[model samples]
Target: MSDRSATAVVLGGSVAGMLTARALASVGVRVTLVERDALPEGPEPRKGLPQARHVHQLWSGGAQAMEELLPGVTTRLREAGAHRLPITTDMVGLSPRGWYRRWTESHFMLLCSRDLLDATIRAQVLADPRIELVERAEVLGLDGTGSAVTGVLLRAHDDTRRTLRAELVVDATGRGSRTPHWLAELGLPGPEVREVDSGVAYASRIYRAPEAARDGFPVVNIQPAPRTGGPGRGGVLLPIEDGRWLVTLFGTRGGEPAATTADFDSYAREQLRHPILADLIGQAEPLTEVAFTRTTANRRHLYERMSAWPENFVVLGDALAAFNPIYGHGMSVAAQAAVALRESVEEFGWGTPGLARRLQKAVARPARAAWDLAIGMDVFYPGATEKGPTRAERLVAAYVDRLTYTATGNGRVARAVTDVMSLERGAGVLLTPSMLLAAAVGPLKPALGGPPLTGDELKRAGLQ
Candidate 1:
């Protein structure tokens, strides 16, 4: 713990902000979490977070960090009706190459409604006496020069404006963050930014699972083959809490999912690379109308590359880097970033010189990994980037394509791929000499004829 009684302010009350508050409170810092919306009292939706209606999963890598941060968050989530799904084993996924075989479990994911996940974390973090929650508050700008951020200017629910001083200020305000504008006001150079938008739109709906399949149904996914030369389309059927399946279908540009309810089923069956999601969902009962969004883009602010970063200020989560949600890396990356924040504060001590700059660089490690993973595939789609993928991206994509094909039939190769996908290991793990040799050798087993759904699963879904 630090020797001084420092104060910090975190903007945004989402997962990233809550986790940051928890981290700071644990180290004896008094944290004030400011939110633009009045948070829900339970697992209810908030007005600010429209994306909660879609499917989400916390991969094992992020789950581990959450556990480390909150100690029993995984248990809390499971107790609140979340499912622990073993990767590969309990996931029926169709990769760009072919159907991925259900190899033994090397990693796992936590599946639940985003509302439930956020509510659980919120309750746990707000319980800390050192943290304060300021609801219906909007941030106007930073309150300092380019050399150091002293605090924030905020307005409460009544539109009363005031300045709140702090030893540190963190931005967790998601993709709409005005950090760039705020920094400009402070006379600091704006960070370099990159965006890769696939022009993808998502349509999601909730359905009551078939009676027999509610208890142990596996997640089913059909991914698009971007190299096929047409608009890429895909769908995922995630079994979430309350015996309901959260199904989301997404497509790029000309092939986007329809916003109408009647068209949801047809799009899943016809637009996806496979009919597995359609077949399974057809047996279930629709519980909600389709919720659609077109914010599937990969954007990153290269803060670490900035020549001059303000002290006592840092940005995390979607405010720093937002990825295409289909890859399910956003939440995981945020949790990992929180861990990085904690480690940096512990190593450098609060208010230390250049501590904010050091922390920004530390969190970027996990963000960079997820950013590359998302863009590697998304950049292949039409209109994804202003200029098509660069030469380096093309080369990396080619190598990754080979690895994916090899993973379809080779158990070892599959595990290696998941190691990175799970965010458990860095991308360097896939480029090792041994991994290169395995990819060169190709898959060891024969290709699966179709989705490897077991007879039991087929029967449960009434498809046998």
Candidate 2:
């Protein structure tokens, strides 16, 4: 139980903000969430989240954490038309080495439009009586010196300015967060930062799924091979709600996908390493114009390594680290970080000395794991970093490449890889003695010549 009545102010009202609010409220903290825009009352797009039009998946690790935070949320998502896809069983993927055979289910993912996912979670989080939401309110700055954060200054929609004092303040303002500047205003030194930008651009569009394929369709993906030493291109056909398919195509630097709808199909078919995504979507009816974005960069703020820190200020979600959406780990990492926040508050009790620093370090554990997974491949792209991948990064990438190649023809190896990809297990699982031995033995079977889609899937998609 908490030592006393405590109040917390959470900045931003997106997934990260709402989840953090719920976590804080769960532990007897009165939370006030401030948002710059008016939040929608239903499952609709908001001006703040432009990337919601593209593909988004919540892996099992995140799903479990969400369920723990808000009971029965998964059921609500399903009732609203979200699909729970089994890991490799419902995935037809082409890796750089070759097509990966569909293996038995090891984990799962929740697939739906980003708007629906966000709205569902937001609705649940805001229903708590202890959590208050302040919409159309802009956060001006942190109110305190470098040693301790006292509260925040805010300007309301009516141009009224005031300060909201709280025992704790949290920043969940996504990638555009001004946390670094806010801290600097308080005379605090900024944390070390690292960025790996692949110059990847994404173009996505929605399509009405074919009649027979609407109920159950596998996700189709074609991955780019960085070893080719040129441009990298890829595409994914994600079956979303409303019997629709969200097709997203991406390329780095020289091979970026065009913004015109006329070229969407050709880019998927001819530009990617495989043509499965194009063939599947070629016959489907297009439903929306292409939505393109170029904000796909992997960045991390080393807050845990800072020599000095504030007493009651913490940063979470993309405000702390933002990864390329291609890996689909952003939402998952946010949920896990929220869980870490809850655990830290419960363990140390709110307002305890050094609680903020402990929570920051705890949350970074999951973020760091997801960071390594994303940069493992992103760092190899041409012009991704100021300097090329360091020697250690190169060595680690080579080992991971071997594991990926072996996963194509080995079921055990594939499960091990998915364990890490699902965010259910840490990367240490791959370094086990048994896994090392399996990699040494190499793949037990020959590489697949083509995508391992079942006959029914092919027939339904009109590819047969």
Candidate 3:
């Protein structure tokens, strides 16, 4: 281990990297965040993240983690046009089980442009004097071996070779991370890998909100059913800041949506299970052109379960696990993972033996929960079930479908489902005796035939 214990090389500049660096900085570790692309000065796009062109949601679980790491982060995000949408209550959703009643807010989600969200978190992390960034720097490999990683080898993003080293290394490089290659180079056995590709594609566009319906707008969602043995199609119309609505429509494989504005309206109106989202956007003016991305996949690298992991090396964020964007769990899970890292570091103190291993294992605990949720549904896609869903998968999916169906009317079941959706509680919470009984009993109240929007909401949106 390096004697100074002052500097750590953080590979990546996205939310996960920034948050990880922020966590390290809080513990007195001077961090250098390496980014191959130049970060935007404001809420703008960066080359590294193509998904930024799409709408993103920050779940309450993630929001809570971010708030803990950086005080007033949610406030900052909201001040920048991000909307904190309450769960179930604020969401009009149709699940595989049935139409979810617009019950009271069980949880909440922050809706906004990916660029603005990144910029907000980036600015806060960069403001910390101890956390510095090395733009145009690319991580090459590890400096040490299986026993313990001494540092990282980095080069100018443009340089073909030559690298700079640090005392400790963190891989927060997102879904495309090369940690596996680096580990092989160090002679360490590669960790197990798990993936469930939903064959999901996302098409998103920004809309100028009408003069009226700006504040207190609800989120509209229609989920696809995997059990139907047909393509899953989903849509969302969310209220962001600056009088804008970020609408994203997505489908699996054959049902993939288009990015063209013309198709945006048509798809929403014709393709989706509900007409609410399409209707909402019909009244709003088109802002930016539509953006399309099909790279959304459910993948996870089991670094924590590695038989022989090097010390002084850790992974966080998408680099460790990535989920389908449709679920909107990525950011929140990243924040939660960063918190695990922070707590682990605090427990062991800096440079303690087995600290990195302990943190990796601890962080993976929540990661396992999230990965299970994403792949559980994703693996049911047509091509997704190529390998076939396990017996456990079918069982769990059935129970979840029942739970979602129950939540449509039963507030208790709705709360239980929301607790997991918000990620406020673990999956085990749903398996509780009360939840099982509730599921068996069915919804206690009658289900709504349509969205639970009040007459006032319709008036605000200029609904005919």
Candidate 4:
């Protein structure tokens, strides 16, 4: 660890911010985490995190990164009731191409409510003496010029305002970040932004699983066929902690799910391409009202592409790029970016002249991978962008569509696809010569006739 006595002020105390604080503290940086709301002491809901009610899973790619940042945290999450689910193996999904065969596990995901995931990480991060929590404090703005940010201007709940100085400042605030305005106030040029809005609305609810099917239940997903040119509708039933299933139903623009209890079951039963999710939830009992959100736009602020960046400042997580939650890449990308943040700081030393810029560029790698995966499909939605997907995006989507079809009948191809989907590998893996040849030959085996649920599973869920 460097003995430079580096200090950092990380804005926002969500998953990204907490992971970032933990990362910096690992390198001996004293970190102050600023949050707009008081964090909960346990795995309970907190204000301002409406998305916590929705389905959240930490992919193995991210789980590994989180483990590196906070050792033994994964075991803690498991101890707290988070489910360790192996991908493809623990998944019963109907893809646009066909039903995906449940192959041997290539990766895994940690399933639980967002609240539990956040609280678990928060507990571990706060236990470190190097990090301090500044709750119920609002960040007014940066306190320096375009060339450098020396501190943050903060307002307490009592309306008292003061500037807190630090050698480094990181913005881990989510999609609602005001970094663009903050940068402009510092006389910096605004970063270019790209947004692809599918106009997708989400309605999620929790269900107490049927006693016999509560544990070891597979995650069921009904993916929409976006190429059909109709309003895409999809649903996912994730078996979370406490023997509960978190189900989220979503539809693009015209076919959006209603935020009412009465319409929830109907949409799941009839609107999606498959009714497996509905069938699974049919034997369960509702535990919570529908939590709805329309903030699923794919937005990216190209801070790395900016001609100039302020020193001692960096941005990470959703502040850099926010994806449609349906893809489940946001949290994984944030975890990967936090790892990048730490590695970059270590490589260049915390106070290096261009360290902040290097960090910004480094974090963008994982964000770009996830952005491509999300927008590749979302851009096909009607009115997603003023101009439809670019020629490149269309071409890539076509190839990916073929790859998905091949994956359904090819275990090797499925592993490669999941490698990228789990954020464990890059999209370039799909373009390898072997992969291309495999896609060309198409599925080596026949497509699955239906979801590969065992007889016992069917009986347990009362779907037999």
Candidate 5:
């Protein structure tokens, strides 16, 4: 109740945390971002964020949001050697039924090392005069009740914990967030939780792209065929900054990829739906040792859906839900959710009662979209979860399969899919009467016989 303006504490230094700080900081709120680890000085490796070892993308939809939150960030990334890859046009992927031909470009993506992404956003967020970062500061819990959270307690570098009073606290600590436990401590029950894990394991390594493909290589992806009655296996070659290609090979329970050098190339050649990745990488130089994780899962904490929730607190990003990273929607969803946070705060006054609840609920709209898109195929892959898809899941999967098949030949259908995936539009837009009619009418063009690589592209890739 001091005369000074209210303060906010953001827990965790993940992408979500930085973006949350951006939203609040932009609104002139004083923010203290608490991180337990020493952030890297540049776009380099950090021990705490192991997921940085995988393929990461900022989809056009998410890129737009990030741009709005931190102006000129895209330019900064590109100047730092990050490639802005146009979708469909710059990507070659093997869909479930067949190879997906490159359609007319509808969206673009930002490809770079996750380290670069984190560093770039961290710099912009911290640049805000209203925000401050406290390294090696770990959050303990909250100070107020179930209806309204007041502040957060911090454990400094010396392990001495002190209360930092605030009018608000945002939980962006990502998948490992203790928000649920914190809520329980305030006498509020933990929210409903749901998890569907396909027992997916990820293995990623950096490759020095060939001189020809260094600056302009297409993003090559061989997506898993979930309907093939076995564990899903997939691979991607992402062109990142500094002449590097971040290649990741992953598989579900019965068909997992390995982390060791002994097993990496074999899985690259034998397991994936296509041999193109292995063929391409055969001549490339390996830059980093393979890194592995079995932590890919769809976990959701339904905090907003709770009948009673606290004010002055909202959980965004991976704290609210963490989708399977293979989908590459995590960063986009985080960006869009951050947009919702900005919108909600503006719609309602910053300190208004129920502002947190409204923002939390709004953020879930994007989370639900990401979750549905992820679990749609994941639930069908063998050993992806404890059980198979529900009856409703099967129906939805059938429809999506038809749509994917249609999209291979129909540009409009492809655009509709991109519209939703880009986070520019909702999935409901796809279910409109016109889209349903288009789906029923079938594709206007024939399915492509092979990938859409041109003669020049082939020559450039050294395939000629």
Candidate 6:
């Protein structure tokens, strides 16, 4: 099939799905997006996105890819009240080893409510004449043999079922995707799967930031110490649009926070490693009730490893790999995968043999980078896996733990670590001889006794 004449069907209207449709459309492929929910017309709440209530940020790496897919998207987000905050420079974080000093900016993050981010991108993609949206519909299954997918079996909201044939079918449905069952029905062997459940529960709430701290406020993160031989606990305070600070408190297994508003403040103050989050929230007025969820787990399906693969079908986003939100790599990896999809189609003709397999493998590259980062810490948690972390994981974690410790006081080491953490560079950067020497030498200065918040920030938050 020629690129201009090719048709594609994208399942799910998520960030991944929307970006996939945009990418295909950019390559001259007509795209149909099937969504189960009636998407909100603006930056308002919608169903099936429970995690949207929590803190969400796009690291510079992902933001760049989104910009490539849809030009001027970041500008639109800024016009709609998003903030582009430089990493480390605009961040105050406490890692497992110690508090990270605010170093010069090496990368950045796009900060705002997930609702605003989605609405901006949605408006941009839907305006393209090559892409059509089919809302309030359910995707029943794939419509061909295990060797190839010809189309999809879709059911409308009114129980009307139909087969919509297409040249390509992309699955971007999130953690609840049933593609495995659908593959089994087509007589294909199941893909290798792995899950690392940290048993963390998230409770988030919004507050009106104190007037002095409403604008140009730094992101405050108190990260969990996973090696403590106890349930991990952490919290983050993000100053988003409309002068609101979105606060999310999380704890693993035995340390999970309570869902009630009464316990929210106490958990941040007493349960987490620091009381800064609690102090900041105390000075602000509550804007919404606590939003809670415990579905945070790192799960991956190795579809690319399958010996016999189907053509014209590819899985992207959370359907291929879902990470614990604590790491905040899910959206970034999905954006990168969509970029890979577009580039693959451009490089190899869309109908080339083995194209689907090539796309799946290409998509896994970003997911693998993110998976290692998440499992490095999560795998050490109690009961994260039945057999515990592999020997390779333990060795890698030991090195990463040391590097993280060195990053606390060394500016050069901090920048190197941020490169990988931001997804701009690969994990191999940490294995360089220079990095090895830096880790062995340890931090150049003594550890900080408190969060590295400036005096001005303290005064603004009324903590001083």
Would you list the C-alpha lDDT of every candidate in the order shown?
0.92, 0.92, 0.84, 0.92, 0.86, 0.93
Candidate 1: the clashing residue pairs are none
Per-residue C-alpha lDDT of model 6 across residues 155-228, encoded as one tens digit per residue: 99999999999989999999999899999989999999999998999999999999998989999999999987
lDDT of 5 by residue, 1-464 (tens): 22467689888888888998888877767899888898888887876878889989988989999999999999999998899988788888888867776877889999999998888998888888888889988888988988888888888889998988887788888888998899999999889998888888999999888788788788898888888788889999999999998999999889999789868899988888778888777878999899998887899999888988988888889988998998899999998888888788778877777788888898898899898888888888876667778899999888888888888878888889888887778789789888888888777787777667778767766777
Candidate 5 lDDT score at position 127 = 84
Clash pairs, model 6 backbone = none
Scored by lDDT, model 6 comes in at 0.93
For all the candidates, what are their Cα RMSDs to the real structure? 0.9, 0.9, 1.8, 0.9, 1.7, 0.9
List, residue by residue over 1-464, the lDDT tens digit for candidate 1: 65778999999999999998998888889999999999999999988788899989999999998888898889999998999999899989899898999999999999999999999999999999999999999999999999999999999889899999999999999999999999999998888999999889999999999999997899899998887667999999899988999999999877999999878888987778888888888899998889999987899999989999999999999999999999999999999999999998999987789899999999999999999999999998999888888999989999999999999999998999999999999899999999999989998888888998999999999899
Q: Tell me the spans in candidate 1 whose CA falls farther than 4 Å from its real position.
A: none
Which regions of candidate 2 are displaced past 4 Å?
A: none
Give the winner by lDDT: 6
Local error of candidate 6 at residue 210 (angstroms): 0.4
Task: Indicate the worst ten consecutive residues by lDDT in candidate 3.
Answer: 157-166
lDDT of 2 by residue, 263-348 (tens): 99889878988888888888798999999999989999999899999999999899999999999999999999999999999999
TM-score, one value per model: 0.99, 0.99, 0.96, 0.99, 0.97, 0.99
Candidate 4, number of clashes: 0
In the range 260-298, model 3's lDDT, one tens digit per residue, is 888988999999888888888888888888889988888
